[model samples]
Target: MKKIFYVFSVFVLFSLVSCVTADNNSKKSADNSSKNAAIENILNRKSVRQYSDKKVEQEKIDTILKCAMAAPSGMNKQPWEILVVTDKEKLEKIAEIAPNASYSKNSQLAIIVCGDKNISERFWEQDCCAVTENILLAVEALELGAVWCMAYPSDERVAGIRSLFNLPENVIPLNIIPIGYPLTQEQPKQKYNADKVHVNNW
Candidate 1:
């Protein structure tokens, strides 16, 4: 009877370990799939200037904004602020100020990335840039269309945006992103250059 009891205990232990190993392998497979999905999304991203008239859902806009905030910042300053503009008049006005954003008129909405001067003024531009890239990446992931329009480093453009948005003196607009459904199918450019990579030392 004692021998039988010991055998039963060993069987149970082996079963538990097998189940644990299977669970761990399943988790690893899931993680790898998720990682590949992200890479695929990044590789497929393209700058879309023409957009269909279809209006972007607020839920998707919220998701894009959430991803923008998730961008990494220097010293965790997180100094970025996002403005979602859906008004037609305002969109037109934006195009007037920055010709690079002329596509904004056709897009259902525009996202204005801003940075606060108080949150490490020296690093605000870099942080805001990261946020803009995040917005673009998220747009691609969501199968939406968008393009990054220049707003900073141009005094005239900055002044025009400031007046249009009534921005405070401390807040600086970084860029304008016009987003909607693509009107035409576009392909991502092959920009990777193997020669640029240097291992260990240049």
Candidate 2:
């Protein structure tokens, strides 16, 4: 019965190979699904100024802040301080002080991203920008709306925020982001520029 034994061995080997192939294919599909979800989240991000009155959950706010901290910092300086404002009076005052960010008056939450010169003297602005971007992306992932208002580089906005918050000498406000549920639906735009891309060499 040598032939019978040989046939059984071949059959078992073929079955094992098929099972392995199936498992690998399943894992690959899962990986692709995760990648696609992340890409979609990036593409679907849109600036939303108007917001619903519904308050944002504290858990989502914490998650977004965690993502902000996860941003890349030059030389690992990691120099960003965050401020969360939900008080109506403070938001109104901010809106008055920063005219361009009038949306803050109606927002349920406002986040102020700050740079600490004492921590990373040279790269604070760039690092704080990364932190702001992470905050926006995380907000989008949580199905919340947010719009960023420039704070730094503008003497009026910067000084206004500094005086309002009583920030120390080394602290600088970078941007103000108002986050909440969307009042008006907006779609993401395709901003890819072929002329702006250089491969290997400019």
lDDT against the true structure, each candidate: 0.94, 0.94
How do all models score by TM-score? 0.89, 0.91
lDDT of 1 at 110: 98
Tens-digit lDDT track of model 2 for 91-145? 9999998987889999999999999999999999999999999999999999999
Query: In model 2, where do residues sit more than 4 Å from their true spots?
Result: 1-13, 199-202
Clashes of each: 0, 0
Model 2 whole-model lDDT (C-alpha atoms) = 0.94
In model 1, what are the clashing residue pairs, if there are any?
Answer: none
Candidate 1 residue lDDT tens string, 1-202: 9999999999999999999999999999999999999999999999999999899998999999999999889999898878899999999999999998999999999999999988879899999999998999999998899999999988899899999989987888989999999999999999999999999999
- Model 1 spans > 4 angstroms off: 1-20
